[model samples]
Target: MPDIEIRQLKKDDVAAFKAIRLEALEMEPAAYASSVEEWVSLSDDEWASRLHMPVFVAFKSGEPVGVMGLLRQKASKMKHRSTLIMVYLRDSARGQGLAESLIDAVARFAAESGVLQIELNVSSENGRAIRFYERNGFRAIGLIPAGMIQDGAEVDEVIMARRLT
Candidate 1:
């Protein structure tokens, strides 16, 4: 594989971000809570607002390949925690250790930001992802039954977390 570059997304990256994000939602409908239909109609400003958080994008030789976001809790009491969301990689980029790099980048940022923990939700049916998270030190903290409705069916979601401090 070529050198993969991961960096914080800027406001001007709205178009690239939208393209990759839409592809993710469309290609892997079961892995995400939001559907393509829901995200497709979002205005430019709405998409740009997503970058206000600590969202990072991965590029393989100048082409966008993956994206992830870290959202810090705004409430004072929960400020030590952040949720990892919107994690996705293009089909061509999987199984190349890129995901681990992304997770490490986020964890490093979390530690620098004084966050004590990071949380994420993953579909129970995605065994590969569950194992990947576990390998990266994130353990299942809880399970939400019927947490997401996909194609008229209820799917369970596992809540996973890792302590950064």
Candidate 2:
């Protein structure tokens, strides 16, 4: 493949981001943290807001092929924590270490952004993702049964975090 460039997500990237995210939710149903229907009904404004969030996308010639985000929580007690979410890559872009690169980018961003810990919930059945997170220095904190419901089924999720402080 050609060179891939990582950049901050932009408002104009809604369609591309939506397309890849939908493909992720549909193709790998058990590997994601979201549902296809949720993405299907989201309006352009919502997607624009998403693009404005602290998220990044990997581009190959201006086409978005991967995305990741760090959604900061606002609770005073949890001010040091942010939820690591929406990690996905287009099928053709998989296996090129994009996921690891994305994770590293997020880690550096979080550390620099003053977050003490960044956490994400991975589906229990997604062993590869779990291992990848662990390999990237995230440790499993606990298991939440029925933590997330997807497509009428309740699935367990593993909450993992990597400390920046």
Candidate 1 C-alpha RMSD relative to the actual structure? 1.1
Q: Which residue pairs show collisions in model 1?
A: none
Check candidate 2 and list the clashing pairs: none
Query: What are the root-mean-square deviations of the candidates from the true structure over C-alphas?
Result: 1.1, 2.0
lDDT per prediction? Answer: 0.91, 0.82
> Model 1 over residues 1-165: C-alpha lDDT tens digits?
477899888888999899989998988989987889999999999999989998888889888899889999999999999999989988799989888888889889889999999999999999998999999999999999999998899999999999986
Q: Please write out the lDDT profile of model 2 over residues 1-165, one tens digit for every residue.
A: 468788666798788788767777788777766678778999999988877667877887777788788888888998789888888877788788887787778878888878999999999878988988898889999999998777689989999999987
Q: Which ten residues in a row have the lowest lDDT in candidate 2?
A: 1-10
CA lDDT for candidate 1: 0.91
Worst 10 residues of 1 by lDDT: 1-10
lDDT of 2 at 136: 86
